[model samples]
Target: GAGVSQTPSNKVTEKGKYVELRCDPISGHTALYWYRQSLGQGPEFLIYFQGTGAADDSGLPNDRFFAVRPEGSVSTLKIQRTERGDSAVYLCASSSLGLAGGSQETQYFGPGTRLLVL
Candidate 1:
C-alpha cells in the first residue's frame, strides 16, 4: 500500500511533557526502524522491529524513550519527561526481511516527525 507515513509532521511541547509519535509502514514489509536526528547530525538508530516484536532497542538514550509495534503494522514512539535535548526529527523506515548484496532492497524512508521541546 503506502510507502511510509508519520502523523503530526511537527510537534511543539514544553519540557517535562509527554509525546507519542506514530509511524505507518508499507504493507507486507516486516521490518521497521526508528531513528532520531538533531541539527547537523546524522540519524541515529533508536529501535528496530522485525514483525511485531522489537529485535533491537539498544539505541534508546534512557528510560524516557520507548516504542511499540503490537500489531506489526503501526508503530509508536513514546517519550516521557521530555527534555530539550530530546528535540529532534524522528524518522521511520521499512525494508524487506532479506536484501541481496547486489540488490536494492534498501529501506524506504518516511517524512520525519519534527519534535521541538521548548
Candidate 2:
C-alpha cells in the first residue's frame, strides 16, 4: 500500500500568484485531512474529507483557499492571491476513519508541500 504523498516538496512564488498543491492518500483510507504549519508553530487544520464529502472545512482560513476530493481519494488544495503569510508547509494526512478513540485510527502524515510566497 502506498502511504500519503504530496507533490512539489517546495514551491516558490511571488505575491498575488496562485498555486495548487496535490495530495495522494493511502489506498483504502476513507478520511483525508489538510493542515498548514508555519515556522515554529504547530500544524493548523485546514480541511477534512470523509468519503466524497467534506466532513469539516471550518479550518479553512478564507475564501482564497479551497480544496476538493471529488473521488474520495486524491485531494487538491488551491490557494489564490498567494501572500507572504500563506508561505508555509502544507501537510496532508489520512486515516481509517479519523477517530481518536483507537490508536489504529491515527492520522499518518505526508512529507508535506512547502510553499514560499515572496
Candidate 3:
C-alpha cells in the first residue's frame, strides 16, 4: 500500500566524493526510473529498469553515474566522483508498466533527494 519513497531527503557532500541514493518503489510495480532535476528545469531521465536489469540507460550523462535494481523492488543510484555540476534533486519514479507503444502510464514520484556538492 505504500508509495514510492527515497532516503536521506537531503544530502551534502564535497566534490569528488561518492554517494549512493536509495529508492524504494511501490510494491509490484514492474518499471522503475531515475531522474535528475536541475534548477529551473524539469526532471531529466537518467535510467530505467524493468525487473532486475537496466532496460534503458541512455540518459546517463557520463560513466560516473550508474544504477542497479538487483531484486526488482529497490534500486540504488551510485555516483562516482561527484561534481558541483551534479548538485540537483535526484528523483525516483515507478509505474505499473513503462511506456508501451506510445501509451502512457501514471508514474508516482518520491520526494527527491536533494544533493548539494559543497
Model number with the top lDDT: 3
Off by over 4 Å in 2: 98-104
Task: Report lDDT (Cα) of residue 81, candidate 3.
Answer: 99
Residue range 1-118, candidate 2, lDDT tens digits: 7799999899999999999999999998888999999999999999989888898999999999999999999999999999999999999999886455323688989999999999
**Top model by TM-score, which number?**
3
User: What would the per-residue lDDT of candidate 1 be over residues 38-81, giving only the tens digit for each residue?
Assistant: 99999999999988999999999999999999999999999999
Candidate 3: what lDDT? 0.94
Misplaced by over 4 Å in model 3 are: 98-103
- lDDT, residue 25, candidate 3: 97
lDDT of 3 by residue, 1-118 (tens): 9989999899999999999999999999888999999999999999999889999999999999999999999999999999999999999999887456211888999999999998
Pairs clashing in candidate 1? Answer: none
Worst 10 residues of 2 by lDDT: 97-106
Models 1 onward score TM values of 0.93, 0.93, 0.95
How many clashes does each candidate structure show, in the order listed? 0, 0, 0
